[model samples]
Target chain A: GAGVSQTPSNKVTEKGKYVELRCDPISGHTALYWYRQSLGQGPEFLIYFQGTGAADDSGLPNDRFFAVRPEGSVSTLKIQRTERGDSAVYLCASSDIAGAREQYFGPGTRLTVT
Target chain B: AQSVAQPEDQVNVAEGNPLTVKCTYSVSGNPYLFWYVQYPNRGLQFLLKYITGDNLVKGSYGFEAEFNKSQTSFHLKKPSALVSDSALYFCAVRDMLDTGNQFYFGTGTSLTVIP
Candidate 1:
């Protein structure tokens, strides 16, 4: 089975620009999550979606960060007015219907805000 | 707030020698622990998880983790080390009450297996 897939493996943008990162979960995965990993650090939670609705978004750093899963299978993480501090690898993961199930991860998108 | 800790920044073991990577967690409720490995320029790969039941859980690549409730620890171990095992290891924990379904990850530990 195909694991989660993210598009635009690498993206470079100027500060204050906008960028969107896409994620395609497995065929039947109903839960999707987004995380950010900085250099020399572990991944930090960003947002999560259960089905079409975002079940929990408290992990989102600020209002500038937003994510959506309109069709329940594909998700997009959007950043508005990106800052240099936001440079990192954006990871996407998906799991089965059960919340506690193991999550499959994608290669991730490396976003660089110069 | 839930958090995970990896006391060692790096661990080095000779090939064929036993290896251990320590991890501890702090959570408000029961903990769902997980171990993941990441190679350079790659996404995190799931190694194992300890949900419940048996304290000793076995996982992929001849890896295992022991869940110690009394010590609030879930340490990753392997009977023997291989050079290919060198990578970044992460320990994560999810609190039962965390409605967001977010897992808190440790700082990460780099493992190097010398051949």
Candidate 2:
């Protein structure tokens, strides 16, 4: 079985540019999550989706961050007007259900904003 | 205000020696605890979880964690540390009250096992 996977393993972009990170969750997973990890730090929650609806978006740092899961299998995290502070590894995870505490993570999309 | 804490920034041990990584958590209600490991240039891998039942929970890669309710701690331990076990370990906690389903992670603890 294929675990969660992300596209564009590494992305280098300039500040004020827009970028999108994609995630393909495991088959049959109804819950998807996005997190950001900075150097020497643990992952921080960004957004969570149960089914096709976002169950929680409180973790999103600001209005510039947004995510969507249209068909409920694949998800995309979009960041508008990227900043140097956004330079981090963007991680995606999925679980069987929203209540399931265990999550399978993807290799992540490392975004370097210069 | 759900949060997790890993007191040590790093832990060093020799191969074949016993290892311990401490984690503490705070939540409003019964908590669900989890442990994860991250290798360099890799995503986080789930190690184990404590949702209910027995206090001692075993997980992947010959790892186990002991959940202590009184101490509000879930410490990861291994009988014999291997050089390959060196990586960053994270402790996470989820509040039972919140239906949003999000895990709050610790600062992470780097493990270094010398062979």
DockQ of each: 0.74, 0.82
TM-score of chain B of each: 0.98, 0.98
Q: TM-score for all predictions? A: 0.98, 0.98
lDDT of candidate 1 over A1-114, digit per residue (tens): 788899999999999999999999999899898999999888898888999999989889999999999999999999999999999999998988644677888999999999
**In model 1, which runs have C-alpha deviations exceeding 4 angstroms?**
none
Which whole-number lDDT from 0 to 100 does residue A31 have in model 1?
89
> Candidate 2 residues B34-114, lDDT tens each?
999999888899999999999999999999999999999999999999999999999999998988888899999999999
lDDT (10s digit) by residue, model 1, range B42-87: 8899999999899999999999999999999999999999999999
Model 1 reaches what TM-score against the true structure? Answer: 0.98
Which is the leading candidate under DockQ? 2
Q: List the residue pairs that clash in candidate 2.
A: none
Question: Each model's C-alpha lDDT?
Answer: 0.93, 0.95
